[model samples]
Target: MRYSLAIMAIALGIGGAQAQVSPPLQVQEIGSFHVGGRVVALGDMPKREIIPSPGAPPIQMDPNGEFQVEQMYAQYIKLAEPRARYPLLLWHGGGLTGVTWETTPDGRPGWQIYFLRQGHDVYVSDAMERGRSGWARFPEIFASEPVFRSIGEGWDLFRVGPQSGWNPKAAQRRAFADTRFPLAAWDAFARQSVPRWTTTDSQIQAAYNEYVQKVCPCVIIVHSQGGNFAFNAALAAPDKVRAVIAIEPSGTPSAGTDASPLRGVPHLVVWGDHFADSPFWQKIRNNVERWAGAIRDMGGTADIMDLPADGLRGNSHMMMMDTNSDEVAGRIQAWMARRGLMR
Candidate 1:
């Protein structure tokens, strides 16, 4: 059954001080697990002496031990009366953790709760080297150093505002005139961005594929850099992945790759506004477009939801956290219903 906007509104009253979901959304179970990683033993590594913490005794650490690395972390909520046949896996973008689907920066319930109230079991994940999935020793287990995203880079690259409009002071920052992102919580959102590694895509992909094999016959909801992982996961196991919903995905499979395996899987590519302003996003969009076109050409159900063109305007790359996030999620829910994803 489809849920009403009232259910989502009930979730809006969720925050730190006010953590209540009226007529509380029922759930049978909530759990988490670590998936997909290999144990690597580093031989011929040097030993180092370092303090474990402030005012602590120095300990000699041997950097030549076997360690587990590159595993992904996932937490799930199984509704007592789920309305969907399969769980919904929420995958975050680069430099982000599963927190993307949790509470918003503005202190509102995020897509995790929204979809939960909509009657689907939800699984939120922290990709390898992110959040609960700890990082490994660089230049050993990992290929290179990690890259961090600065507030200004996020502000500009995320389309929250132009590069010239960003100011250290929140009051001085100028957002897109019609932006729906809550500017007051920009710093809070930045806190969610973690250090991301450019060279770990292969590891991340392997972990995500393992995750899919572990818990699927499910739909995948991906954002930004996760697009590549989601597409590859589905391609690797189309039988397990029922559908994919990508929001402002920054990358995709090579348009030349055979997409016939996904001809049976439904795909929804959602885009926000202001593509003309960023050449980088334009290139990304065109690439995804070509890939989606390829899927459709192979007799697959590949749909596009251009928010602005659909009359839902003022959205940015972080549309899931925008002021109108619930509305966007509602649109996605409606599409899922049309695709017969709901029970």
Candidate 2:
């Protein structure tokens, strides 16, 4: 289905967010696609009744479970521009949906439009079991209950502010004074949260694999947990992946995995600030550096970008949502151009 620039902006908007930006857009085509998931026999639900008044007649709702299995949910937005060398596929991190690439909480345009206006055919997706994708029953289809994230954890884990003196009033109390993330949009950011499950990781991986196959020979831009997945995806099918750009990925493949798989595809890993305050991230950063070294040793192209060291500071895990997001995108675009990946 093709969507006009204005229509897409409206569809993705919440109450106050600005419309998507698509200027100088030479988009020849814009559409969506889905991959993964299987059909299943849906079970029936218990009946329920509603009464308008006490001791009055009641109305009942006995919904029938639609029979037949369905595919796993992973939605994709495809925007094609003749200027791009190849397609650009985006993958989101854990606990988030495709909205990660959508408008920022501050009502600003997202990377999706940023790249589109830059002349690349971009595909943004809702990973398996994410938004618009269907969910299964617990224990029956899903092996475990879905896990959730709290705003407090986000404030700390995302490095939006100091861990101490954190509360629902985080926006007013202690947001990093210099953080690019719009403090006023704290509530909007929280709305992007999604249920995450450890037990379904394999399924998620499979779904991602299917997605990669469907959109191969493309550059991948992934963030947080998506970082590792993008690497593995390239490793799993190097021919399908032209390059990979990981933004603060949460994990990586074991050292035992062959780095040669990705030797042909260029790799770029980027990190934001706040590692000094988060030990967990410090370890991850160290490991990523080491991994990059190992890949380089194997005659692979593995580059690193420490945003803070690069003179861009006060960024959080959600750096793309930071105030300097377009600047960052420009940096990546420059790199891609140097590599002859895009116009």
Candidate 3:
């Protein structure tokens, strides 16, 4: 999946004069892989394939709307010392591509590079919809005479037309009717999409399983939304996962909802104090503590760290890129090293 970091700056009107202009939105592409477009067959695996190396030339997404490839940008500088264990799978946060794992602007190594240098194989992927992922073909799919007519019929009924409010429950009925055709069309297209993106949790598990079969007993390092996905994936196949490091994961579903599929996996929950102040970061600490407690209660290890107040210069959520990134990475590397996950 290709994760993207979207930065939006809103300018609010002030008094009668021109509104103050905020900083421009700066989007940084994180994930390094893109799989969406044409369909290619990789025998039973479909069109998915791991790129030969991190430096491999970029590949285009297939026309079928999807493609899958893996990149290993950093390599272990030294051989693993005897008794070293599992490799690590590094997953970036939402709106970020895999590049988040690379070195920072100041040349200080990122987590992935640090781990790789310590003798661990590190992998990164781009989620669907961003980066080199295929484009949506809505116009073409809905362009046919019959399709256009069907869409028009629904549109007419929703608006003031001859068949306007054909049903007394027009508001609700129109919404369902109008959405049905497009939803179906997209569903059809998605089915035909190649190097398909994993829409369901099962697909994610399958992908993880495939990778694990080749690199058994791997540790998962997931940031933000990736943390949620990794937790569920680990629960689905605990044997393949050695441990998980979650950096500010999203909360589990509401009450009466299905519990997280974590299944007592060992996890390290890291959060920044900024989450306590920011509205968006609201509930982050609560959520992290909730999961941490659950993991510990289930006989798994769970640790929570608050980035020092001074360490958080800007948004706490951005500590991963802060001036103290190397320090943060060092702490993480020390943890992994203690676990025998790195040389």
Candidate 4:
């Protein structure tokens, strides 16, 4: 699927240093739906006057009513001709939506389109309280306030650069010499960060479990916080989860949890570079590694793809958005093929 420039130019009947263009995607059907939510009923609450928009008149709002909350939203693309045996489900990390798999911060097509072009029907989702999935009231339905991520916090936490290297000016900002992330799009990436709740993990897991039940006998590709949900979802419904590809997963189940459920499942954990530079990421990696080890102990297929070790270095935590994202994706595609998940 790697298109050389000469071949592309010949195919398009053009020549001489032109930018490469992707072929049109062949899709059978495209649709979306909202899944996994419960209704919350309230009573005896006071009505309040609130403005619905800027320069708008205030209206009386009813506080006591039945409300739907904690639901997850999902959109899917089914290819005209699929090469994979089952559909692929993509789950995003914390503070992000299905947008994580759709487009890169630099405006490049992301893994959603990449995998579809690879001939897999793909389902991209917005976890509960994210994106089009909508959010619940804080301290009431959500039980906690939403927490937002700062740009500098992401720069440091995502291993894009050292904390000291971050500057308000992109020109003044310093990044790891070998970093693959698109530094110029750092601010645009920050716009993708949403306000995440600390206490919503259980609700998120529940919704993910329901989602698996709804759209699977499938493989799932998860990143960061979505890793925990994907792992637990497989444990909850082993028959439905064909395989798991976790790219820089931020968390995992406790190492002691019985992983026998995954004995028949294949798992791949992909890591980018610069783990040694962040103690926080180092701890996260160890925790996920221990969980993978536990799965191996249970006779499951749990493999690690350390990009640096594979000589695919300079990837940030957001490898899917990195410059060489397609290369990283090709690696995952190969792993899936080796696992016999691909046709």
Candidate 5:
């Protein structure tokens, strides 16, 4: 069930206000469910009614369960004839939304618009819980189980075994225990709810087949954990995807697995140099490069981009949201242009 980027944009253009600088984004709850249940709404607010950010338009959601903001900016319509442009699917990292790809902290136009200006149709979204998209549904499922709850409580639980604790750790007694169960539950909920989160490698391939047959074959741009999902998806439909660009992707799904997906697709792996400072940086990078090499070895194009060792600071995970994000965006543009993906 694929929809054209143009149709999505128009549908999303209906109610949201413009963007603002300070709050940048505003999420309003138009409706709610039971206590401790989820709330259906316009923006990214948790409880309480959300206020619109100054200069930003109010967000809107349609009765069909489609989030308009994601459609409007992330999924773009071609300005010229549809045949003349390429389609691109952009996925952000964990805890972020499609808006993060389109707007900076100051609320000005961001990367999605940059790609739009370059003449490519794009679709972006908050993987699941980060943005105006459904938040409660996921939490409810994760909150149902204790093991899953622990997995969801901290970051990197999925990558490093759960024993790593909330901060970071080495191998543990059990991969499930090291991670917060709540977090795992959340991830499971996301996979079950999001159309893109296919449970098995074969399902991902099926999704690609459907996308290619229904929509224009697209270039997949994934950041962080999305890199994992996109890779698996591409592995499933190598013939349908044009290319893959991953930004600071997390390392998982060991390269040695016989089911190692992404065996024969053009791929670009971008990593923030700050990751070098982490104690586990070497192991993580090795895993990432090994996977990249595997893709290339299987006849897929693969490359890696390491951010300036000192240019972008803070946590390595924060590189995407850093003040110098434009630099990253520019590099992405260059990469796309080099691949002839940009129109």
Candidate 6:
């Protein structure tokens, strides 16, 4: 029960009206840490030539800068006065930043605030090489060029609807029809998508390991591509990670990988709807099922949540950005309490 008048008031979205919630968080701290090798030399790189005026021609500069910089960047916002036994750390999927946990595409609150209000110190991170964590030049630092996500890809992959066309309006229509994602905020969500480099996974995973080591005995909530990193983080430092909530993780520990480290640690694997209809997603579901079984065999408490099975249906791949996101967060909060992680 502490207050900070300068920063306490925040508007809460309930029933379409504004209600100010004072001190949504007791303490908020923001910072960053660099990782991996640094490039000491300034070098030439390609850029779009912009002509200033009719008489002034396009300018091409070579070896323009002279400063050392690192490729991996790790930024975080730590909220204090937590009611949970350990801090809750949120890791976003590929091509996204910590914004994934702060606001939905449709302009709703994200899980970061949800958990904070529930009395848990929270740490929302922008993983290395994404968002605030930066990237080095392709062919220089990265093995390949970064790949960008398109609206069609997002719609198909995120289970928003059958492949929408490339046009923004068409995608918007599809998103509206999907009824899972906040259609009005579809463009906003799309704006957050960024390029990602698969070649940098090792560096990214290493940074994740360091982050977990630096802040341990904490609960990790991971989404999409973040699932594997979070899973491995728990495995790498079993004594440090108390619980894991993998939301539709992209991959998992192989059946042969030893999950014994997770013994007595609560783990939850949550799945959204529309997977059975998609052959591609079905395989993913099958893989995670086996992985969960493997962890159980190794003496860990692993529970699975198939949203449709629980009567919550029509959820897209981006469940955190779905219309009923708060409902989903509520379920997760209850799960934490049931596991005794909540105070």
Model 5: CA > 4 A from native: 1-77, 81-85, 128-216, 257-264, 309-316
lDDT of 5 by residue, 1-343 (tens): 1234435555676324442222111222122111112234443434433336887765653333423121111234444432213577777755445654665444445666656555566666444333444332323232321122333332442232333444322232233322212232233333322222222233223333344445547888777666776776666566677788887677445557543345545688776643433556567677878888776776667877766552533323434444455567678778877877754
Predicted structure 6, TM vs. truth: 0.83
Q: In candidate 2, which residue ranges exceed 4 Å CA deviation? A: 1-24, 41-80, 170-172
State the lDDT of candidate 1 residue by residue for 175-242, as single tens digits: 88999998999999999989989999999999999999999999999999999999999999999999
The C-alpha TM-scores of every prediction are: 0.92, 0.84, 0.54, 0.94, 0.55, 0.83
Compose the digit string of candidate 6's lDDT tens values, residues 1-343: 3344424333223322334344545666777665554555655665566676789978764544654433445555565556789888899998888889987776677887788788887787777777776666667657799889885577778777666433467433544343477766766788898888878777777788878878778999999899989888899998999999999998887668888888867899898887855798898878878888888998889899888899898888889989888899899999999999987
Model 6 misplaced stretches (Cα beyond 4 Å): 1-24, 28-32, 35-80, 164-167, 175-178
Residue pairs in candidate 6 whose N, alpha carbon or C atoms collide under 3 angstroms: 82-121, 83-119, 217-240
State each model's C-alpha RMSD to the native. 4.4, 6.1, 16.3, 3.0, 14.7, 4.9
Q: Model 3, which residues run further than 4 Å from truth?
A: 1-84, 105-107, 128-214, 253-264, 309-315, 340-343
For each candidate, what is the lDDT? 0.92, 0.78, 0.48, 0.92, 0.50, 0.78
In terms of lDDT, model 6 sits at 0.78
lDDT of 3 at 52: 55
- The local distance difference test score of model 5 is 0.50
**Residue-wise C-alpha lDDT for candidate 4, range 1-343, written one tens digit per residue:** 4466656677878865335476667888999998898999988889999999999999999998999998889999999899999999999999999999988999888999999999899999999998999999978899899988888788888898999999988899999999999999999998998888999999999999999999999999999999999999999999999999999999898767999999998999999999988999999999999999989999999999999999998899999999999999999999999999988
Query: Residue 181 deviation, candidate 4, in Å?
Result: 0.3
Q: Name the lDDT value of residue 216 in candidate 3.
A: 50
Report residue 117 deviation for candidate 2 (angstroms).
0.9
Better by lDDT, candidate 6 or 4: 4
Model 5 lDDT, residue 214, Cα: 50
Candidate 2 overall lDDT versus native: 0.78
